[model samples]
Target chain A: MSSMVHHFPILLVAIPILAAAITMMLRSKPKLQTGFSVLASFSLVPISFILLMNVWNSGIQVYEVGEWGKYGIMLVADLLSAGMVMLSSFVSFLSLIYSLDYIEKRSLSTYHPLFNLLIAGLHGSFLTGDIFNLFVFFEVLLLSSCGLVVALEKDGVTKSTDKLEATFKYLVLNMLGSILMLIAVASLYATTGTLNMADISVKLSAMQAAGNLPWHVFAIGLLFIVVFGNKAAIFPLHYWLPDVHPTAPSPISAMLSGVLIKVGVYGMLRVFFFIFTDLHDMFQPIIIVLALLTIGIGAVSAVAQTDVKRLLAYSSVSQIGYVFLGIGFGSLGAIAASLVYLVNHAIAKSLLFLTSGGIIHHAGTRDMNKMGGMVNSSPFMATAFLIGSMSIAGLPPMGGFISKFTLFDAGIMGQYYKEITIALLFAIFSLFYMFRAWLLMFWGEKRDVKRYGEYSEHSISPMIYMPIMILALMVLILGVYAEPLLSIAQATAVQILNPQAYIDTVLTRVVR
Target chain B: MNNTLLSLTISILFGIGTFLILRRDIVKVIIGLSILSHAVNLLIVSVGAFSGKDVPIITHDEVASTNTIFIDSLINGIFAPMLNGTNPTQYVDPLVQALVLTAIVISLATTAMIIILAYRIHEEYGTTDIHKLKRLWG
Candidate 1:
């Protein structure tokens, strides 16, 4: 392989950092800054696609910083992280483009830099092999996201004070989680004598095989779960999510809900599959039970929500449950199912949030009860919203159907009969709430909707439509022809299962 | 004995931190996070303890002769280190120290950010009680 290929994994993160710095220098020129940031985001697509393709064949690629030995910080772009990078790049690019016409130029310039930084952070969290580096990236992403949420402080709805308060709560709780994770990593390292993931995995297995497992090792793993669960918005630990996600700008919401929470999922899998593979029996069952409860509670809560963004926020909670359900099962089929669901949810849910942004911008309210027959006024927005709804609802001929079906099938295949049964039942409930929000916003007789000064006549910008169209088209294509995507997910799942492949590739000296 | 003492102190701090987090005050929360960090640092440093030896550090050839979990091959052949093939005094678990250092930095950064956020909340809302900030929910 060419030495240049090694630069791709870290560059996925570095490019945006470079872009943000250049953006700061160009800050006096807002339009230019916005243009530069947009160009930078679009550039990530090719880089991400290339990395994903490399990992698809190579299994995993480790890029150690400074050409340092195995003891130093390493960035491993395994199949799983590579795929997430690809999805995140596509979503962030589209979201940036969408923001062009939707937000004021003054706000867009500030927002776009932070947006690029947030994506960079997401890529960092995914690629970093050192556990502590993950914490650093998590903070970077969280702080930038909070900055964007307060960037445009509306007077009443999502006001500055409320945003600050909510962000503070989110920060405090997330910091608590991060502290726990650090403690866990410290404890694990003390016992295992290695910070490299592959090295730790080998040592952990030997400890277990020796029948001398340290009690603190178990505590460390549990602590990691709590931290990751908080990020993933798992039910018991998800109190901050509903408050925080919708409090941000709609484009930011798409990124947060679309990409950020999934980092939690990624971390959980990394710890479980990569670092503590021997502790499978202790952890997997707990995850499965939690998945069941998370799904039930998230769906039940979603049905009762009245605010459009809040409802989508709650729906995200329910949708993430599907991801956990597949992960918990731990079979080849289940992992594949979960992988498919992850991509599908990122697109469908983000589209829903973006459409909600359009609705709120035009209608001047987030309350679904206040919205009426917007379909008559904004057919394109309504149609896009319906397409998003259908995909998320798992209707036939949509990406949601394929992913959800795979998850359910995998659960059954793995003898998780109850899980599959419950998932199917809640799948219907998800459709109900999605359509309920849809009807209240778009289907009723036109009422006295508070129009927001005719929307700059820029609602249909190519940047705005491109993300929606690309995602919508992906949904349709994946629904009809899921073979290629599933194959990619399948290869990734196999890599995740036999995490030795990843550990050996990164920690051991490869024979030339 | 040192290991036992270290474990006890870490556990105690963790307990106190947990209790503080349950309280309503924001200041208490910051203290709770700090206490938790120190507790982790203690737990990490204690994991490398071995009996009848000072902390693992190389001073000279004489110091390198100390019995531990990672004695050199030649010394092990002569003395036969007690812990089976594992020498009891050759290597310090450098991993824990590295983790502890990173944890300290991360917690410090977060603590600083938390204080700023608290000050901002105090400025904007005139109070820090989360229960009173009821604009978004419901």
Candidate 2:
């Protein structure tokens, strides 16, 4: 039993993928399929936790799919991946449970399989050893998510048609990204002659020091930035997110905003710190400019949204900017803050979506104009929503405030003046949008009364309430007790900055 | 030398593809995407430049070794060896091949998805002009 602990990283990915297959095979029985999905989703938590503990005790863990010379694929559990695994797995698990009730009214044929596949793909993306394999995992996630969007569209023909169009647009743009990424990977392989990430890093670092022609490396690296930027929803490349996110089912929106976009961030870090650290100085300004723009645009757009879900969607784009800002600072402190903020945002944003699900469920509309005085009516739900909002807005005693504060402090300490200015501006903009949400939904004279007016004053269903409550509590806990999370993030950041540490671990069997 | 030719052709295709992608027509965009994708594929394959080889496998039983066992019989080969090692230093970079194969599959998938998206846009809006679909733009 103890010996099996080493396989946890692979298991995190394998379980969902195998479950997806098993679920598809059991399509004749929806109950069995849903049960298997829930079981599979639940199992990821323990596996991720065990791996997290192992990584905490030891250093990073690596699972080469086969022996390196033979298979050339590896899955590693470093600090960054382990932390993301825990967040993604927990959110996926909770979302599945939430979906059990939420998806009952919706179609089931494609939902369960696609949902599980998306989880599998996300897990694979986080764990993958080689760049090309990461792209494969991304494509799997993208295709399955497209199916998910169409599956959850409302019954009206026009609305469904609109959703279908938006979903197609998302698919096309993502496909464009995939093509560009493949080109970059191929170019890298051509130059380096190896697909192993650690090997490429070492080779590229040597080439940089030798002062040889570095154009191939730089060109490929730039292409990757553009490709991952599209997926990450950076300011200029974020055209698809607001439309696709709101059109999907609420739970799917949570996963896309919470997990999918983060995959892009994960890819960026893997490349930036591991494969391209030597070039960081050259690229720092470019990254800072993009991050600042994404932050400003996301906040401003979020403020103008009347649709509750769209507002949350825009807020996600804004919050994603902070993650980028943290990355732009590129110090130990900045990286740690970014990691902590990533986890916090995942929880807070998912909580917001779940609460929106409650509102959408009760009100049957997404317009905030149609929702008023719900705070007095369903105080439990309203309060939970406020908690998520405040956490995202960086208010005191909540997780977002501490995480963003550390990020800004790190930026200033690093003397990246432009990024600091952007952070301050985003801070003010975030407060505006967040409070605007509160004022419109909770404090107004009861105006739109159709959805919530009919319901008796009672507790929200436990199925829905439990996840949001847990997330809300986590937001507070993450704010107050930042040490444990910070340590995990710090360890991950250290491993990323020092690529040799990761290379030595994964290439344990490789001879110099 | 041959690689340079392939590289030039690919760059030309890529340039044209980018132009098409910027146009408003959906079909042109797809064609542009395909062109860019093929150009990229060409560029990647060319990165592994293979020089004096007749398709690597030598015999049914033995794979091509890095160092050639046979010597030129006329002058230097009866007592001396032409190749230094059993395995040649230059093999078709297997890593690039794998990356290319995966790239092809991903690109194919993306192409299919884009085509479907184009069809859907045309069906609903009755026009493929991107400007007409700009409902949310400021």
The most accurate candidate by TM-score is 2
lDDT of 2 by residue, A1-512 (tens): 65687888889988988998898888788888888888999999989988888888888787767654313688888877888888999998888777777764447756888889999999999988877789889999999899787665332211656576678678768877987887788777766656778767766776677676458777787888898888889988997899988878777888988888999899989998898868876766677788889989999899899988889888988888889888877888898889888988998999999888887776556778877777777777788888888899998888898888888888889988776886788788888888788778777676645544553434567878888788888888988887888887877888777788887776556421
Return the DockQ of model 2.
Answer: 0.27
Q: State the iRMSD of every prediction, in order shown.
A: 4.7, 7.2
lDDT scores of the candidates, listed in order: 0.79, 0.79
DockQ of each candidate relative to the true complex: 0.35, 0.27
Cα shift from native, residue A430, model 1 (Å): 0.4
Weakest 10 consecutive residues, lDDT, candidate 1 chain B?
Answer: B72-81
- Cα deviation of A67, candidate 2, in Å: 1.5
* The best candidate in terms of lDDT: 1
- CAPRI-wise, candidate 2 is acceptable
TM-score of chain B of each: 0.70, 0.72
Interface RMSD after interface superposition, model 2? 7.2
Tell me the spans in candidate 2 whose CA falls farther than 4 Å from its real position: A104-106, A153-158, A448-460, A510-512, B52-90, B135-138
Candidate 1 accuracy as lDDT: 0.79
